[model samples]
Target: MTTELQFFMSESKKKIEAKLPELIDSLLAPESLKKSMIYSLEAGGKRIRPVLLLSVLKGFNQPVEKGLEMACAIEMIHTYSLIHDDLPAMDDDDVRRGKPTNHKVFGEAQAILAGDALLTYSYQLVSTISEEPSKVVSLMTELSRAAGAEGMVGGQVSDMEGENKDLSVEELEQIHHHKTGDLMVVSLVAGAILAGASERDQANLRHFGRELGLLFQIKDDILDIEGDAETIGKPVGSDAGNNKGTYPSILGMDGAKQRLEHHLALALSSLKEVDMDQSLLIELTKYVAYRNH
Candidate 1:
């Protein structure tokens, strides 16, 4: 990644990290529940989802802080997903972001509650946005659709059912489009909405986000085979051990790499349609496409 992008991401993370604790602390939840929620939030990540949301605002030459509340909301949703995804019934991961999983540290029940709390609070935060009622409604509507059964939840169900079964590339793509891509697309669209961009501009961002999300998943699949356990914060080859259908498993390593490159090009192409200073967004795409973790 470029030094400038690295600096931008680091600053972005600092902003989100500072705001997350404030959000959780302002709630009137039980102490244990608050601890569990904050514990997972403090676990290290690149803050990509939230950063992506803010980056879209930056791309429009708007103040990044204008979207900080919404960015934190996005991060909460992403973090909640991780907490649940690491449960014994799901991916069963022992570690995340190089620390013990929330379930491992807080026990299964509290971890589940923490995830539920975060998910619920995220919507509350967005719903309270001081924008016009229409924009607030638009944000809430898009967020629900992206995070609910029609999006990530449905894709996760499909993922669980597809385990150990041979799935076509189209099937895998379908799973990820809703699973990972939709949330990302909505992040960009949310920014466009906040920035008062044209509908066409938002559509362009949606197309870019789809390809970018695919690129991210394909790279993740490839990394599951070749990434360092310490760097990626998990055991290598876990997907293969679990018999999950991954891009490398289906397409072979070289083919998966080729596909990653293909989407990178397409993402850049689609991003060109956004009417803004897109250098930051372009760098952001490369950041996702080429991340080590």
Candidate 2:
């Protein structure tokens, strides 16, 4: 990774980690719920979504502080998803971020409520962004669509249904487009929208986000096949164990690696189409492609 990109990522992570706790502390909720929510939020991950959002804002020369609330909102929504995804009814995983799953630590009911609280609290954070009401409304709408039934939830349902089935590549892509790609696209596009970017620029970033999201998932599938449990913070080969359709499963390892390069090129090309200081974004894209964990 470039030194500049490493510095940018570290600065972004510091900002987000500081803001997350402050947001949670402001909530008027039960102590247990608060504890449960904070537990998962504090559990370590790359914080990629929020970092991407902030990086986009910086790319457009916007003040990063202006987008911090939205970035925190994104992280909250992401953490909530992880919490729910680890439940017995879903992937039935017992570990996340190298720790016991949320349900295991907090009990299933509290864990469910914790996810619910985070999801709702994300909107509260969004509502606080000091932008024009129209822009805020637009952001709220984008977030709702991305994280709602037509996006992540819908994709998740499709994923569950496709387990143990020999899903065609197109079908698998359809499932991932909504499940994993939507929020990622919104993360970049939301920053563009907030920066008062031109419609064309916003569209280009959205395209970049879509390609990057696909690339991110493809790398995840690859990691599942070849990543170490210690570095990845979860068991390798979980996808194969569950018989879930993944890039490596459908396209052989070589084919999946080739697809990764394809999406990486597409993502970079899309970023180039937009007229902005995309140095950070470009480096971040490379980091995503090569991230080990």
Candidate 3:
């Protein structure tokens, strides 16, 4: 990662950490489910999704506080998905973000329940936020579409089924477009919509988000091949080990790097058109392709 991107990630990490407790308490339950949920959510991550959402909010000239709940809700959903994705029946990962998988720590049953609770509670958290009711409703709809059968979940299904098959580039693109790109698109668009952004700006931001999302996933694939386990906080070759289709698998390392650069350029160009302080987003876009972890 570039020094600038490292600074952005470090600053964003501190912000997420500061709010972690309140976010957990806000979504808390009386049962052990709460404990499990907090355990996994607090396990540590880049908090990239929430930071992205908040960046868009800032870009659109909205008060960052106004998007706080939305940011937290998206993070909750993302964390929940990660927990479930690491289960023995799914990716079967034993460690995540440099710690034991939720199922490994909480047991498979409670881990499942914790993920369920976080997913369900996300909607509740968004609903209670003080945004326009119509906007909130629209945000809820967008999030549902991103996380449901047509998006992340569908991508997961395709990924699982594609493991043993020789997936073409088009097929692999379809999966990443949904699995990784969809929620990212939602993050920018939702922030724009909530900030009362012009329709034209929203379209531009969505384009930026799509390119950014694809770049992010391609970098992840590269990291799987070349990153350190300690730096990436997971098994470095898990993608190959699991027979997962990836950009490098189809494009080769040089080709994948070229594609990442291309996407980053397009993403930066899109953001350049907007009248906003894009320092963080620009750094993040570059970092997505350059990060070691």
TM-score of every prediction relative to native? 0.97, 0.97, 0.93
| Regions of model 2 farther than 4 Å from truth | none
Among these predictions, the greatest TM-score belongs to 2
Clashing pairs in 1: none
lDDT of each: 0.89, 0.90, 0.82
Runs off by more than 4 Å, candidate 3: 1-8, 26-28
* Cα deviation of 197, candidate 1, in Å: 1.1
Off by over 4 Å in 1: none
> What would the per-residue lDDT of candidate 2 be over residues 1-293, giving only the tens digit for each residue?
99998998899999999999888988888989999999999996888888889998899998998889998898898899999999998878887776898999989999999999999999988888889999999999999999999999999899989988999988988898888898888899889988999999999998998888889999999998899988887778977888898998899999999999999999999999988899999999998999997
Compared with the true structure, what per-residue lDDT tens digits does model 1 show for residues 1-293?
88877888899899999999988998887998999999999996778887788888989989888788888888888889999999999888888777899999999999999999999999999988888989989989888898889998898899889988999989999999988998898888888888888989999999999998899899899888889987887788988888778999899999999999999999999999889889888998887778787
Question: What is residue 37's positional error in candidate 2, in angstroms?
Answer: 0.8
Model 3 / residue 259 / CA error / Å:
1.4
Report the Cα lDDT for residue 184, model 1.
90
